[model samples]
Each structure stands twice: as C-alpha cells, then as structure tokens.
Target: MIVRNCNRCGAAITFVRTKKGKAMPCDAQAMPYRVAPGGPVNIMKPDGELVRGYWLESGTGDGVGYRPHWASCRTP
Candidate 1:
C-alpha cells in the first residue's frame, strides 16, 4: 500500500491498484460494511477488489474493506 496525503483534503490515504491496473486512492484504514446494492459508498480490499456497500459503523459487517477517499474528501 502506498501511503500519502491528499492534495485536496490533506487526509492520509493509501493507493490500491484496480483490476484495470489503475491506482485508486482509499482511506488509510479499513472499515466493516454490509452489502448494499446501488449503495452510494464503496469498499476496496487490499487486493484491489472493490464492493459497493454501506458502512457498518455500529453494526456487525459482512466483511472489511477500505473506503474510497474521494467519497469522503473535504474538497471537491
């Protein structure tokens, strides 16, 4: 994982390569989430696998994954 700061928001992030060999910046930490079809948020695995789901903040999750940094970025 390549750790760095966001140029727009300054939040720490890690880059995960996608299946297309593209780097996707994600939050530094992994979060648990439940599968939610057509969800607004996404989760990225260490291996670059991504899933659309809702975060299980106070609830049990189906799996753990990293959140896409752009989804929560402060600056547009």
Candidate 2:
C-alpha cells in the first residue's frame, strides 16, 4: 500500500495495488478516483516525474467549503 497526501486537501490517501497491478484508493470515505480506460491517470510529482494513479480533487458541490487535508488521527 502506498500513502500520498492529497494536493488540494492534504489528506493522507492510501492506495492499494489491485490484482491487475492498478492502484486504487482504499479509503471508504474518499471521493471515488476516476480511472481512465487503457491507462492510469497522470499526476506530476514534486520531482517533475510523471506518476500514474488516482487523484482526488478538493471542494464540495455545495457552497460550503472544505479544507483539504487528512485529519490527524491518534491511536490509543
């Protein structure tokens, strides 16, 4: 599993490799990542290399605004 922070929301998104070798978001509450047929979505990394994976955008459909970022969790 690979964990990456959302660019818009900074949420820690967990990605799992499928049996077919495709990366998929594992969080149930996360917005569905659109998978383009025939190829993976291209995301530009900080180092200028291109990466293929599911990307999530920030902001709600309603007028209300949501801050993008994963909520920090505490383990008991």
Candidate 3:
C-alpha cells in the first residue's frame, strides 16, 4: 500500500501497484478517488479548506520515478 499526501492541502491519497505494474487508487472509502499521471486532484487544507490541485511527475525515464506531487493548488 502506498500513501501520498497532498502538497498543498496535506490530504492523504493512497495507491496500490498491481501485479502488471500499474498504479491504482486504493478502495479505502466508498467513493474512490485517484490522482492520475497528469490529472487534477481535490485536496483538503490544514485549515479544513477544500482546494483543487494536480500531481506533477518528475525524473527521467531511465531510473525510478516518484508520484503524487503537491506543487500547487487552486481555489475552487
């Protein structure tokens, strides 16, 4: 199980890698939420505010890459 926190809001978004090497959102809640490679995400701020943001993927193709970037978020 992989857990990622929103960089802007500090909300938790969890994921799990499948046997075929695909990353998927965990079904911890009744409503499933996921952050795609270049998709937008909804985050909750420390002050209990909801915001919109996206995950930015970094690193080159030759090495291991990381996911779930909280670089920026916008007000909805």
Q: Give per-residue CA lDDT, model 2, range 13-35, as digits (tens).
A: 66544445655543324342333
CA lDDT of each prediction against the hidden true structure? 0.83, 0.39, 0.38
lDDT of 1 by residue, 19-47 (tens): 88999999898787887879878888667
lDDT at position 37, candidate 2: 39
lDDT of 3 by residue, 1-76 (tens): 4566644455565554544565544322222233344446553322223334442354322222222233232313
- Which pairs in model 1 have colliding backbones? none
User: What does candidate 2 score on TM?
Assistant: 0.29
Ordering by TM-score? 1, 2, 3
For each predicted model, how many residue pairs clash, with residues at least 3 apart or on different chains? 0, 3, 0
Compared with the true structure, the alpha-carbon lDDT of candidate 1 equals: 0.83
For each candidate in turn, the TM-score is 0.81, 0.29, 0.25
Number of the predicted model whose lDDT against the real structure is largest: 1
